[model samples]
Target: MNKSNRRKFIGTAAAVIAVGTAASAMPLSTGKENYPVLHHVFFWLKNPDSKADRDQLVQGVKTLKKIPSIQQLHVGITADTEKRDVVDSSWGVSELLFFKDLAGQAIYQTHPIHLEFIEKYSHLWSKVVVYDIIEA
Candidate 1:
């Protein structure tokens, strides 16, 4: 290759590498907030078709938001989608809770509001699955 072509190719390669390095180092979250711990819970209700049961569960979840240690809370119902082999729509309700750290989550676990929530709403769901995640 001629000197001009070689110089252009080298410059292009250096630009690509610089862009990739900067992208990889960028923070994933918005600068205003940082939630490192995530607690996800899925609930399979005893009577999935009953609106009363769903409403009761939703109400119970709202009370949980009052807990001081919880940074964020989201409660949702499973969405209707195309039936597929991999889809698992058995869960009637899903809840996501975010905390600043594991210590905050620990406090939430034993908080009176959380315990009260369980006592009030445990009988509505037959199965529950919880997944906890920490940011790397």
Candidate 2:
């Protein structure tokens, strides 16, 4: 995708990573605390060619911001631009979420809104992948 075009994947890997990422952060030996976790989720749709399915997924992701524990939420899709050897374009939709701390993330997991989102939208995707990053 071009710089002007923006969109964003991990598949079956998502659910496992989402839960594990918060639990698996490694602190620097210097003792700096990990204050925030960046949770990036990738979704490969069962009907990757369907615009309706992809749009619905993106909208569903937007609803996650209602959860108080989520500091930020961004919904995106695959971009149409240059394909690099390292770029992943298999997924149709992606969400980048921010949480203040692991506790916040844990709360988000059980939050009614988050649960509802999964129940309502899980069927759209055939696979999910999640990546969690903590600032060094």
Could you say which candidate leads in TM-score?
A: 1
lDDT tens per residue, model 2, 18-131: 778977786548754345788899999999999999999999999999998787888899989898999889899999988888888889889999899999999999999999
Extract clashing residue pairs from model 2. Answer: 1-81, 1-82, 10-129, 11-128, 11-129, 12-128, 14-128, 14-129, 14-130
User: What clash count does candidate 1 reach?
Assistant: 0
TM-score of 1: 0.75
**For model 1, which pairs clash?**
none
**CA lDDT of every candidate:** 0.94, 0.86
Q: Which ten residues in a row are the worst by lDDT in model 1? A: 26-35
Instruction: Estimate the TM-score of every prediction.
Output: 0.75, 0.72
Model 1, position 88: C-alpha lDDT score: 88
Please, what are the lDDT tens digits per residue for candidate 1 over residues 34-105? Answer: 899999999999999998999899888889999999999999998899999999899999899999999999
